[model samples]
Target: MSETIPAGKGISAAQSKIENRLIETVVESFNKTEDPRLKVLMQSLTRHLHNFLREVRLTEDEWRTAIDFLTTAGHITDGKRQEFVLLSDVLGLSMQTIAMNNQAYKGATEATVFGPFFLENAPEIAIGGDIAGGAAGQPCWVEGTVTDSSASPVPGARIEVWEADEEGFYDVQYGDGRIAGRAHLFADENGKYAFWGLTPTPYPIPDDGPVGQLLESVGRSPVRASHLHFMVSADGLRSLVTHIFVAGDPQIEIGDSVFGVKDSLIKSFETQPAGTPTPDGRDLDGKAWARTRFDIVLAPALT
Candidate 1:
C-alpha cells in the first residue's frame, strides 16, 4: 500500500461521493431525449443546477427541505392557479428574468410581469371607454398610445388589460361576481388607446405556501404597488407585457413584494371634469376618477 497520498487526491473519496448526481441523471435523460430544444433546456438546466449545488455546498437536509417545499407548492397549484409562479413573482425572479430577455427592446416600452391573472377572453371595448364597470376604489381613467421603435403608431394593436377591484381583488378572487372592467381593445388607425379603469392598489401576494413562509422569514410584506397590467401586441410587432403605475401611489417608487415596479412605467393621471360619456354610453364622472394617458412602443418581431 502506498503510504504517501497523491497531492490532488486528498479528498478523492469525498469528491467522488459529492459529485453531482442530478447532472448525471440529466445527462442520461438527455441521451434519451430527441427534441433539440428540450435537449438544450435539459442540458442548461443540468449545468446550472449542478453549479448551484456545488457553489452552495448544499446539504442533504437543505435539499430535502427544498424538495418538500416544491412538493407543497405543487400540491397547492391548480388548473387556474400556479403557486410556483406566485413564488417566482414574490421572489422577483419572474420580473428579473423578463427584464433580461427583453433587453433587446431599447427605447421601446419597458416590460413588466404578465402576473398570474391574465384572461384570453376579455370583452372587447372601444377607446376612451370605462373598463371599471362601476367597481369602487379611486375612480381612474387610463389612456395611452401604442407605437413602434421609430415612434410610428402601431395601428390596430391589441391591448389586453386587467386589474383588481376597489377591494384589491380580481375577478378570480371574488369567485362569485361578474368579470367586469376586464377587456381587450384595439388601437385605432393612429395607434392611440385609452380607457377608464380604477387605479391599481397595492395588493398582497397570496400567502399560503412555502414561498410565503420564506417571505415571512425575511420580514418582508407581500404588497405589490398600484398598477394596471397590459399585454400589447400588434401586427408585425413584438408582444409586450407591461403595466402603468398610479402616479400618486406611494408604492410605485418603493420596494414591491415582487419587484415589478419600473420608473419608465409611471404616468400621471390627469384629472378631468365630470360627465364624459364613454363610447358605450357610460358616463365617466371625471371628478370621481383619476385619469392617465400612457404610450407603449413595441419592437418588430423577429421572424
Candidate 2:
C-alpha cells in the first residue's frame, strides 16, 4: 500500500500563513486590554478556539450554524428562561465548573449547580409556615439546622428554599404570573428551621427552546431527579448552594440531566399517615405528608 498522507499536508504555504496570522492577530488585539485578567482570558480563549477549529477542520457552514444557534439561544432567553444556562447544564460544563470551584471541605456540605430556576429575593416566610403558596402537591415538612464545620449551631442563618410542585412545574412555569413552592426564612435562635413544601418529584428541563432541540439531536433526555433546592448562609461562613435529593428517586441512579446530584445529598422522605402531628404541631388532619431532615454544614469564610 502507498504511504498515507498526513491531514492538511496539501495546504499551500500562503494558506498556512493566513491561518497563523489570523490567530496571532486575534490574540494581539487583546494586548491593550486594561485588565490583566481580561487580557489573559481573551488571549487564551482565542488560542484555544483557533486550535479547536483547526483540530476539527470546521466547515464554514458548521461555523455559520453555530453562530445561528447561539443567536437563537440568546433571543429565547428572558427573565424567567435561561437557554444559555440550559445549554451549559446539558453540556456538563456547569457541573465541571462547580466541582473545580468547590473542592471538598471537611464536614461542609457539597455544593451543586445553582440551577437556572433560582429567584433572588424570594418571598420570606416564617418558620413552620408553608411555602407551597397554594401549589398542588403532596405536603412535605422540611426541617434542618445550620451548623459550622465543627457542628456547632449557627443561629440567625438565612435559608432560601425552592422546588417544583409534584406535577414537575415551578411557579415560573405558570403563565398567569404566580409564585409557588419557594420561600426564604431565617433560622431560629437555636439554628433550626422548619417549613412545609411539596414532595420533590422528577421533572424535565424546559424543552421547547434551542437547548431542548440540542438535547433531542444528541439523544439525551432532559429529566432531572427529584430534589429540593437550598441556599444557606450565615455571617463568617461560606454560603452553600445544594440540594437534598429524594432517596430512591428512579432518576437518582440515572445521571441527573444537569449533573447536580451527589450521593451525600440524598435523603429519605419519610411518609407519614394522615393525622400525624408535624414537628411544629400542625395537624395534617388525616392527609398523608412527607418529612425530611437536612442539616447544613458551612465552612468558615476567608478573611
Best by TM-score: 2
Tens-place lDDT digits, model 2, residues 1-303: 112223466676677667777888888888889999998888888888887786688999999999999999999898988989999988889989988877787879998988888898789999988999999899999998999988899999999999999889899888688889999999998899999999999999999988888889998889999999999999899888899999999998877999999999999999998888778787766799999999899988861
- What is the overall TM-score of model 2 with all chains considered together? 0.93
Residue 222 Cα positional deviation in candidate 2, in Å, after optimal superposition: 0.4
lDDT of 1 by residue, 1-303 (tens): 112222233447456444644456555677667798997777777777766666566899999999999999999887556789988898778988997878856688888887878767878888877677666677676766888999998789999898888777777666665677588899999888888788777787777677788889899887788878899898788889998876778875567788888888877866545665544455544545556778788988872
TM-score of 1: 0.85
TM-score of each: 0.85, 0.93
lDDT of 1 at 61: 100
